[model samples]
Target: MSSTTLVIGGTGKTGRKVVQQLRALGEPVRIGSRRNSPPFDWENPATWPAALAGIDRLYVSFQPDLAVPGAAKAISDLTYLAVAGGVRKVVLLSGKGEQEAERCERIVADSGIPYTILRASWFSQNFSESFLMEPILSGTVALPKPEAPIPYVDTGDIAEVAVQSLLDDRHDGRIYELTGPRQLTFPEVVEEIAAATRRYIRYVPVPLEEYVEGLRNHDLPPDYVWLIGYLFGEVLGKPGNEDVSGDIERVLGRPARDFSDYVRETADSGIWNRVPSSS
Candidate 1:
């Protein structure tokens, strides 16, 4: 059996880290991305088999998100192909509180392949690397769900756990809920960033509908707007979503990175210090 591991979404947030860590451990890895040799695209099933060929292990991070429509069927089809191709183990990155993502989890679990699921809280990097970055750069983060206390886990921790799951069969069939050690509300997050960067950043809480309308007004894709709305409405502030989990410590023998730690490190990188351009 081939020992190669295929990391789907390998260029993405957690995927890239997983790839890096695996490579650091001297494990064979193939990046499954549209730009790779055997391109793996989520929307195109024809690209999958080639990427899965000769691969014994897999790391699944769905593009956009698994909450989107058709994600379950996509996971189902991918796992089916993997099983037929003799892929031995699979590790999936999933959203902590998303019901829709759970459906995709079931597909991978029942696929007759050994699997581990990492159900993660909202990422701390969302503020520095994702949609929230723009608002931070603009100095005013007008978002909904101001009061929702989120245990924003770092992608670094998530990646470490993922790498452990991929290489060690001990993690097989285990579902790990990954979260940071503390919860912070939107305003508190802003304050931490503000202090770390020594820049004035404001957090304005808006109505959910108003926030969605703002995204539409800015001409963001309809699907992206829909996802933002779904995440804020369905997942944020829901009970238990804010609770911190010790799974990271359990898996990696260390406490999960705190949001403040992320903020300080990212601040040192000067990502939050960039001057916003005036149009």
Candidate 2:
């Protein structure tokens, strides 16, 4: 019998891929996004019990982020509802170095549910889809730090592991630290994209305060600003995690996708095709 899984953040990069993979595997997949059918919102606990009902497994990808305020409490409260609603297995998509995210992880660990935690590095899609995409398209990528080496992971790998964890019991109680095959600084990544698209992309390194001011001027959330600041300030430029993880290959029986592959794919997809201004 196939398991019925509720996939939260179903429209996100990893969650979307997970939903696709699960549906392809013939499992009953329920999308748990506020925008999707049977809306599931973290801020609204009243919706939890309904979404958790009949869900044997859950792929938990917290939106905006899990590191924000009240996330731990939300996860804790949801754990009770999940267990009460008969959810047996849960796979969480988490940031590798986030303390607030770790709090949510602990909530699930103690929730008596079969769980797998994927502590992922910065996603390669940040450039292709997220905040970095805007700057990349403008051809002037300016960040707080230029020397920061981010071991960005592909969302594809994260989704693959999440699906296995949800479908297979072998990954229970495991924490997987997922990263890219190689580490590249911000400037180096810009160069890679430039090399791939054959466009002259520029990387302007700014002070942390300047970066924050830039974001503030745009009315970006301070929570998002904190997340990015914590990441680039605390986690990046670390040497111990500079190499690719064996967890992806070990779990999937395949090599992790290279950064070059991600860049080439993004380039061919025509997602970044604006003719940059010369000024």
Candidate 3:
């Protein structure tokens, strides 16, 4: 009998992929989103129990990020509920080299439930699907840590590993440091997209403070501004973050998707080629 799995951030970048893969495998899946029936919300603890009621396994992708303040407590609380609610296994999507996210990892580790932790370096989709998309579309990708070589793992890889962890007991009690096959600096990344899309995209290196200030000037949330700063300063600025990991290949028996591959695929999708709508 297939156990029903609850995907905490089911509608998010990796969560949606996890849900799709699990469903394609004929496994029962429940999306834990505010808009779903028996909604599961991070800020509303009351909604968690109903969502966890019949869930035997869980995929935890915390909203915003696990590095944010109070994230540890939330993970701890969720883990406690899950254990008591008969959840047999858990898979947490965690950020690599993030100190605060590590605190949350420890909570899940000691929860007494079988678990797997996927500490991912960065997502290659950021350029096409996230904050960096605006800059790319603007043709001027300005940011800090221009020289920080990042092995940006693909979300599809992360999702596959996550599904494997949830279904396969061999992954339990294991922590996988997931990364791309190679590293690329910010400018190199921009160049790859430019070459793939045939667009003139320029990369500008700025001070971390200036970048954060620009986010603030755009009227972004205070926490988001702080998180961007934290990620750039603490994660990217930290040495050795550029190092590649073979965990994805070890688990999947295939090489992790390279950034250039991601660029080519995304470029083919015509997302980068779309002209920015002047609203």
**What TM-score fits each model?**
0.97, 0.94, 0.98
- Following a full C-alpha superposition, what root-mean-square deviation does model 1 have from the true structure? 1.2
How do all the candidates rank in terms of TM-score, highest first? 3, 1, 2
**In model 1, where is the ten-residue run with the lowest total lDDT?**
270-279
Note the clash tally of each candidate: 0, 0, 0
Q: State how far residue 64 of model 2 sits from its true place (Å).
A: 1.9
TM-score of predicted structure 1: 0.97
Please give me the total number of clashing residue pairs in predicted model 2: 0
**Which of the two candidates, 1 or 2, achieves a greater lDDT against the reference?**
1
- What C-alpha lDDT, on a 0 to 100 scale, does residue 151 get in candidate 3? 90
What digit string (tens of lDDT, one per residue) describes model 3 on residues 120-176?
988998887788888899899988988788999999999999999999999999999
Question: CA lDDT of 277 in candidate 1?
Answer: 61
